[model samples]
Target: MWRYEKRLQYPVNISQTNPKLAQFIISQYGGPDGESAASMRYLSQRYAMPYDKGKAILTDIGTEELAHWEIIAAIVHQLTRNLTPQEIEESGFGPYYIDHTTGIWPQAAGGIPFNACEFQSKGDPITDLFEDLAAEQKARTTYDNILRMVKDHDVCDPIRFLREREIVHFQRFGEALRDVQDHLDSRNFYAFNPAFDPGQKPCGCKKNQ
Candidate 1:
């Protein structure tokens, strides 16, 4: 159960319309590394999470990813709103306009419709968490690419916010992974961590240094 908030997590007021830019940003809405996949991946994986910390973080981040999706949607909407016929054709938005007509639809910039294959929900917590870490980085990289192309402060500011959240989410997931590992029994299958951090105490979750 979620408490419905009528406000965006971060405010987005894009005064100028840029259909070309919207075409690229729309990928974050439904692309492989997009928030839509992140939300679904984490939420679905929580069911198989053996650790409470893992479950909690997954739910928290999953809900937040939904908010990120809305943010992306709002950005895309604002950029494409009030499009003229010539702007649509020149921006190469005609195909999408034919289908969505400025409405939000789940598809990559290349027009690949979002699908379940975009994410994973493996029952293994370690595997899923590792997958999540990679996902966050991928999203951050996508945001970095967007920031490079975006010239408008109004557009890049909110995108920067989203990018920062990706980095934060990556950190949070890292903490949750360490927590889950720390709490595991020696006899557990995942107890033998092949990827254990070097130059760190084996009992690694307690220190800040």
Candidate 2:
């Protein structure tokens, strides 16, 4: 159902190798608020989204998150490529190197392996969209942290692109949240679960009420 694209969503061409930088950058690959978590969260939540617009937004953003994941992987790959053992030890990548030499694995900066616990997929559309918005902001903050520690233009350029995307996605999710809110009864947004309580009217009160 998905088409293959031979190109990266944003091109990454790093001329220098820095295992230290790679260590931090790898967090975005499998860390909390990372692209992998974002993709899975949105894609999984889409099935419960009641509105077509919400579903579409989730689908589009989820796909885009996958693209961002690939970007992060590429950055990590380039940064660790051609690393010498001496360079790895000096760069403080020795612990990581011992486990997987120059091989890209999904782990947080602290070496926590990627896990679903990093994100949530509540069946409630409101909760999920809010989580999406928060996820984007968290990702943006992570990128800012990376930018502060890194000076290489080759690395910073792509990181900046990814950060800007987080902003855009945050905006889109905000709009999606507003759309869902508008469909709910003004009296009580939580009166009913729109996704599960199909027989209830859009603005109707709770079934028990």
Candidate 3:
């Protein structure tokens, strides 16, 4: 269960409405490297994680990513607010308005809808951690790209915060990966997966005396 918080993690108060910019920013909502993908990636991967520390990391960061998703929704909502029909048409938000009427929907800047294929939840710990590490970096890059195009102070502020969190997530995933490697069965850590493979020493298990 999650506790409800009425306040945003970061405030987004845009004085100007810019649907064009919102179009670009929406990608991080449900786009490939978006918060939605990041949240699902870690949470889903947590089920198979071999270590509690890794699980905890995934839970903490995954929940945070959900909050990040809310922040993005807020940004898009504010950006697209108080638009005239003419403004919407001229800004090239016509296609979106017809579908959702200024509602929030997950999709990339390029117009591709959010898809599960965007992130992976591989059952293997090494594989999943590597995937998480890469996901965080990619998400960071997305925020970086957003920053480059953003000129408004209100938009830039929260974008920067999100970008910083991505770096922290990457560092956390790195720590989880290192922990996994350290606990691996040295004799066969490379030979087989202690998480799954049998007929071999499992990580964290003692040999029969």
Candidate 4:
């Protein structure tokens, strides 16, 4: 049994729009390395995790990723600001403008649609956590790359925020890894993947060893 909270971890307000930058940032919004994929991957993978701690981390992180997905969408909206009808048509934003009218949609920079194939949800806890950790770093790197590509303060601010979040998430996953592995039997700690051995004690906290 799990409890879920529906809320964004942060707020996003993009006051201006630049369609050019919007196109670029949309990659992180809906691309394979986007927050949308990251969130979905972790949350979906939680169901297969064998331990409560892993499940808790996955749910929390997954929910947060949804918020991040929203934030990225907000950034895209901001970046696509003030497009005239002519500009929209010339810039090839007309198709998007027709449907969204400055609203956010999940699609890559090159207009590649989002798909579930971007991520995985293996039932194994250790494997899943490792994947999550890598995902966070990948997102962080993407944000950094975005920052490098753009000079807008509005875009950079949110991108930086997202980048910091990746660092924080990586730390949390590290702690979760420690919690899960430390619980294993001392003798078998290094014998195999730590998540598979339930016989391992919690935290390896033996007082009389």
Identify the leading candidate in terms of lDDT: 2
Q: How accurate locally is residue 160 in candidate 4, as Cα lDDT from 0 to 100?
A: 86
Over the stretch 1-209, how does candidate 1's per-residue lDDT look in tens digits?
88879989999999999998999999999999998999999999998777777889999999999999999999999999888999999989899999989999989988999998999987767888999999999999999999999999999999999999999999999998887677655466365332353223456466578
**What would the TM-scores of all predictions be?**
0.88, 0.94, 0.91, 0.79
Tell me the TM-score of model 4. Answer: 0.79
Q: Of the candidates shown, which would achieve the greatest TM-score relative to the real structure?
A: 2
Candidate rank order under TM-score: 2, 3, 1, 4
List runs of model 2 lying over 4 Å from the truth. Answer: 199-209
Error of model 4, residue 130, in angstroms: 1.4
**In model 1, which regions exceed 4 Å deviation?**
185-209
Give one digit per residue, the lDDT tens place, for model 3 in 1-209.
78978988888888889999999999999899999999999999888877889989999999999999999999999999989999999999998899889999999998899999999977788888999899999989989988999999989999999999999999999999989888876555565554676335346777699
Judged by whole-model lDDT over C-alpha atoms, candidate 1 comes out at: 0.89
Estimate every model's Cα lDDT from 0 to 1: 0.89, 0.93, 0.89, 0.78
Clashes of 2: 0
After TM-score superposition, what is the CA distance of residue 121 in candidate 2 from its true location, in Å? Answer: 1.0
* Steric overlap count per candidate: 0, 0, 0, 12
User: Candidate 1 at residue 16, lDDT?
Assistant: 98
RMSD of model 1 against the true structure: 7.9
